[model samples]
Target chain A: MKRGTLKSRLAPVALLAGLLLALPGAPLRAAELDAEQQARYQTLINELRCLVCQNQTIADSNAPLAADLRQQVETQIRAGRSDAEIKRYLTDRYGDFVLYRPPFKAKTWLLWGGPFVVLLIALGVALRFVRARRAAPAATAVDAAALRQVLADEAGDDARRPPENRS
Target chain B: MRLRYLVPALVLIGLVVLFAVGLRHDPREVPSPLIGKPAPAFSLAVLGAPQQTYTLADLKGRPVLVNFFASWCAACRVEHPFLMQLAAQGVEIVGVDYKDTDADGADWLARHGNPYRTVIADPQGAMGLDWGVYGAPETFVLDTAGTIVYKQIGPLSEAVWRERVAPLLQGAKP
Candidate 1:
């Protein structure tokens, strides 16, 4: 009974795994790549963005264009093109947008640095706010003293009143 | 001290304005880098007549408008009449039936009134990749020297043809 239950549970998982593997644009049957080439292939695909499905990497997209691009990448890899050459080839044709991680350059300096610049500005503002708040306690202390004096004067006025008026 | 909060508020408002402006423009209309560069070479079979092959070299030494289209694309159908008009006006238009079956492409051209001087078949879209074509109904205006002068991303309209492409062709002649 235990064995049967386990097999039944494994069946759907195995079927799902098969469906995932059969998805279009998923890497085809493993090519005869050595360890180094395999690593490079993974890196290249992950770095390249799919133009059709802008949100996905070429490796992750199921679009026909992505499949074609993958085939092109594999062909280039087989042709002994270096990783840099392949990246340059795609970028030259498709522009820098095809890269998931765009290169740091003069034009892209703002894209790369804008976040850090904003963060720094925010930090400066927050620091100033904290410092100002810290310094505000002194002013608040003077206000508290005035409040205490008012309370004492109110108490004196109440004490000076007649017992019937107090009642 | 209150002004410190104003800095972030202003930045946020500025970003919101920038995003609003950006939303007005089509994000799919990425400018091609191939403009002002030499057109990519291609040798593809004619759509109906597979025996005859058309090459990019055959149309050299003259301005040619290369259009990429597919039977499956609705925008291509919409642009068909404009292309036919341009062809009638003595414009040499080279058609690339991108990633479409030969029979479907041939049928579409016949039904829509073929506008191309010569039609090439890119069954696998291999040549389309060389030209960095992301979608269908893209048109490129190549100068006499085989340099790509201008590219239009969407379906062609009469206004666009008159405003942008007409001047380029006239400028190319003498």
Candidate 2:
């Protein structure tokens, strides 16, 4: 057999063997989740912040606190609690820091609304400049021509009419 | 004009100065949640004396410093000498063995020379959470009232202990 064909045939098997070897210490019969609950739990965990570790979502952090929080979520899921309830339970225990998207409040108003306000102000300023340029003499020549036509019509009316008494 | 640029330039410098001043505000000075509040309840078996249980109530009415550690935690080993120094200074030091076997914890204590008054074993790590521990080698300083006055995350340096704890020891709010 050609070496290339042999190596190609062996690659997938070797990968499978490596994967099996890597999981030797893993527990048999690992916790199983129903499809619906598994998807909900995954989405919930991805949104949650790992309070103990900096810059890691709860799903990603390996910190003990993160593990506890993850287990707590799993327990809530097993209990048939909704995702909101699970998040509320964790936030209650760990404070607002546990939330990745902080709730809009007096202190957090700027955090939530600052970007939109900045965009609106930028758009307003841009529109003002655009309007100003459009209103400039070169662009407003059409309006200037209309004004000239009105003035010329008045001059023609005066010339056509018998001269009004000098006033 | 050059002076127009100077105004924004000065404003930028002023903002930089303000930001620098804001950055210097230390989180350690913020009163810890564990301060003035009852120490969280914990009951873990003693690492060396396995049959005995170490509870938070056991250390009430005394100034105790609980050091959370693990045999595999390198920072814990780094700060071991500082803990010994704290012990020598008449501060009663207790240890919490975090997620480590009692045998390994005992061996580590023996090898490093134990400065702990009692070493609590948290083999399953339930007790560590009760104390709001994030990682290994976090030290909590408690007052005579059993309230946790300060918590030092990561390795405890002498400078941090002195700057953050000595004032609290002198009866100031952390």
Candidate 3:
């Protein structure tokens, strides 16, 4: 609900919104921080993975490990450590998996480019469908007026025949 | 018949194969970056004897097993007996009581029987964080050179010890 001070932290709307909805109770440490420092603190915790749960970020998880990680972030912030330094400290120990954003490296080339690859393939398929439809010959139109006249004449001829004569 | 007709089907299969691989991979087991790197240096008081301290340097030049555990963790209980078996066979295991109270940790070990060569109290879990521990029952195998070689994320089973760990310890230059 407190989105005013946390706009920067909530930049990735869908990820943060889902995480915040799942966020249980208040966060672990409401460590005293100024406006700018608090914003920085929120950003770090929100982005860092809670390794215990594996799915939830430290900001959303109720795991004790998440709490400890949050506390660590706050402590580092108070110590005047930069955001990059704090992140590097964690990634150094926990690997790049600890960060929600996987680093754009050789190993993650697929992960980074996968969506666009899928999109391109889909576009190609769509284009092919459109082109195939364009190339296909159209069907000949039916003569509706002639068809109605023929049916009417058939009905009249059938009526003109008497019961014995019709046989 | 044409290659373009098969492209979408091929893409669909590729997606399925990628997802299947992801499914097979265990998310709980985070691949440790510390592997092939020297173990993090730590100096913590030994459980039940705060006066004495154990450090990473003490375990150098020998294959060592550093186990992260807590009385609060259920999985640690599962591996306790197996750990005792390893210790009986002269395996030196260093137990780090991660993020647990002194009373509970000591009591739990006393009840279960101590299997560790040296049980260090990591009350605040600062050492655990330094070791990049997110959960209990994590085990790390250090080579003779003090480089972390293997890390097991959960409770040890007899099979894991017999197959993976025992072989690594043998390969470790004594």
Candidate whose DockQ is highest: 3
lDDT of 1 by residue, A117-137 (tens): 999988997998899898875
Q: lDDT score, residue A165, model 2? A: 35
lDDT of 2 by residue, A1-167 (tens): 69999999999999999997886431211176687888887887788877656578878776666777677677789898998888766654345566788788997798899899989978997998899898877643367876775577567755454435322
Every candidate's chain B TM-score:
0.88, 0.83, 0.92
What number of backbone clashes does candidate 2 have, counting pairs of residues 3 or more apart or in separate chains? Answer: 0
Off by over 4 Å in 2: A1-40, A51-53, A61-65, A76-95, A120-167, B1-11, B14-36, B172-174
Question: lDDT by residue for model 3 over B1-174, one digit each (tens)?
Answer: 688668778879988998999899987888998998999999999999999998989889889899999999999999999999888888889899999988999999999999898899999999999988888999999998889988999998899987888788776533
lDDT against the true structure, each candidate:
0.87, 0.76, 0.88
Interface RMSD in angstroms for candidate 1? 0.8
Off by over 4 Å in 1: A1-25, A28-32, A140-167, B1-13
The candidate 3 chain B region of ten consecutive residues with least summed lDDT is: B165-174
- DockQ per candidate: 0.59, 0.15, 0.63
Higher-ranked by DockQ: 1 or 3: 3
Candidate that would win on lDDT: 3
Question: At residue B170, what lDDT does model 2 achieve?
Answer: 79
True contacts kept of 2: 0.13
- lDDT over C-alpha atoms for residue A31 of model 2: 71
lDDT of 1 at A127: 100
